[model samples]
Target chain A: MIQDIMTVAETAKLIEAGNVLLLAGDEAVLRQLPKGNWIGGTIPYFISHAEGGLATRDRIFVTDVTGVAQSVEIVERDANGLAKVYAEGPQEGFSVVIIPALSKAHLSFALNAPNYKDFGVRPLIGWISGVHLDDLGKVTPKVFNGVTGNALEEGAVVLQATLKPGKVAEVGIVNLFEQGGGDILTFPADGFSAKEVLVNGEKRNFAAYIVKNKLDTRLPLVADYYGALVNISFQGIDEVEGEVKFYAPVFTGIRYKHAKPVADYGEAFKACLENKCQLSEDRVVFSCNCILNYLYSGLEGKKTDPFVGPITFGEIAYQLLNQTLVYLEVHDV
Target chain B: MDVPSMSRPQWTDLVTGKKTYQLKFLAAKILLGRLVHSVKENPTPANIKSCIEQVYNVYAKNAGSPSVQEDLTTIFG
Candidate 1:
């Protein structure tokens, strides 16, 4: 539940003692730390006590989990085998993960991790670490496992915390967008690629469908997955292939029944931060917001109140998400 | 497509629809990402100074966060 920034030297002390910690900081700072009982990723942007957003290269955002981590596991650089970490996660409590941004393992875990949900695995909460100013799309994101001191550029590192016997951890997602009135669109096949999708059952090229309807590309495609709002944010519409791609893969079987229109991001986000939160700000143990929301909502210099953490490239709450906020709350049950 | 080549203000100019649509989309997208963090735990001058510099660096590189830019001006100016 610890959320605060510390100097690289101070952070090194936490890592040196083999204390469970989750970290976000500059590459140089993260690289210098003495690896111990911790897992971390690279990111300069964060939601600190300061208004809006702040970036730091000198300090590291440390989430002290020294007493909380009952056990930890590191998932090696296996694309398809990434989900195995969750299978090996703490069964009695919850697990958190840190995956390198834009890695094959990140996409692989996103596509397959949801399967573990049905098996009744412990809640999975974490984010994809990335670099700032990634406009040219040249990103080199990394994840760290202090236990092994592995500063991995691929695969992932997971920390499965078996809360104190009387303690419980619950995962929550806060999304403001709902299905808007539009042609029901869904891809014919799964994976990140979609050439033609059923637009009310009539096949149409995904890009052409978007262009034809003049859809607000900023708004994500939302599907109600058993009452949970699953969002598939658009990456771009390739004119050459006439295909539509999403930040996270949208499985074909999900049958995206609705298009969630984009709302006034500032107001919607403010409200979600204030009212939609199931757990009070004081009770929030760990939370992360999608980078899409951070960029789309103009979050710089704005306060999201109690909901704060690293603004991540992607969010994982059992499944990958876009333009949404995911949080972990521990309750003494 | 030539985002890095364009100046921050030029890229942000698209947000008003006065510039290219692609740049506008990119600008709006980048500007919207807010990094909300609480520094009450360690509000030391050094921390705040580094945070300001970081905010400036992010904005200077991307030129999307005008609010942060204004904050930087207020702090340093």
Candidate 2:
């Protein structure tokens, strides 16, 4: 059922079967697929069901839906589609979203994501599609709604699947990184950029503090906000400005209760999978991991037990996440 | 089939063939560092076995390195 680099002829068969699919492949290959009930994005990296990973431009990653989708729609800022989903999303199955990477919509969604959290939207699970490593700069990332063939980069293709009667879908994340209790680092102001921060009450340049202390950028900064563990992942360090950029903006208003460093990435990752995957294998329907984890933990070929899918630029469970595995599991209610 | 023991250039040649596999090799080195560190710390019979399996999993799974794959099967089995 799991295949890499599928031929157009083979893909045509899946389309004919009327199955709902989530696809990952090159733009040309994806373009060749017959329009049908599917949503896809561009990416060559995949965590397949075959106990390892694969990166291929010739093939596509396809996962067929177990149940027929009740409804499907493409949401775009131009169409006010996200608002519609927020108001009318199904109460049963989760909404599957595939967003193109680094597009205007992607940035808009990431920044305004907290607003969606407040609106009580349906369970959302998805990833940002990306260009192949070789095509990173040459081509823009694209998402596809098989019903529409190709979609604008700045839009999200969503499928609202209605789980079979009596079936229920649950979304969750498996994060291996826990606070290693290092220094207490906090930004003085709310927003994504923290040029200077309070390192245990001492003002210091964020980038300088990281390099001087040799802090592990891979682990991310963990904040305990009202008992909920929210991880603010490191995006990059601006050397000239001495500013630290984050995947998700850190709010100054919310006190960072503590700062956690990843103890040991490889061991922590392995242990987390070992502990969580024992029961999730049979229930998990679809899953995707953050590319940060893929690069930092060296997971190119490593098996993450029951979790597998695309290694995306970013992962969305309800909101954007970094260095974590997000999955949707279904069971009969 | 002696992948772990092979010299860097030899291994790269075997894995990459005539083409350059620079990006793939760069990714491998990062994982290899962790594997080496883990093996050094434990070195237990069980630990060594698991670490070797993981190293192969992370570095050589889709590496197109037939000898390395063969070696992995032989060593683990």
**Top TM-score: which candidate number?**
1
Interface C-alpha RMSD, model 1 = 18.1
Range of the 10 consecutive residues with the lowest summed lDDT in candidate 1 chain A: A114-123
Off by over 4 Å in 2: A1-7, A68-85, A117-121, A225-228, A254-267, A276-278, B1-77
Pairs in clash, predicted candidate 2: A5-A59, A5-A60
Question: Model 2 in CAPRI terms: which quality?
Answer: incorrect
A47-108: candidate 1 lDDT, tens digit per residue? 77654566667888888765555665544445665656545656556778888877888888
Report RMSD for candidate 1: 19.4
Give the distance in Å from residue A280's predicted Cα in candidate 2 to where it truly belongs: 3.3
Off by over 4 Å in 1: A70-77, A116-118, A134-139, A257-263, A273-275, B1-77
TM-score of each: 0.76, 0.73
Give a tens-digit lDDT track for model 2, residues A222-324.
Answer: 7643223556788789888898888766765343423355455557767777774444466777888887777777777787756778888888776666677
What's the count of clashing pairs in each model shown? 18, 2
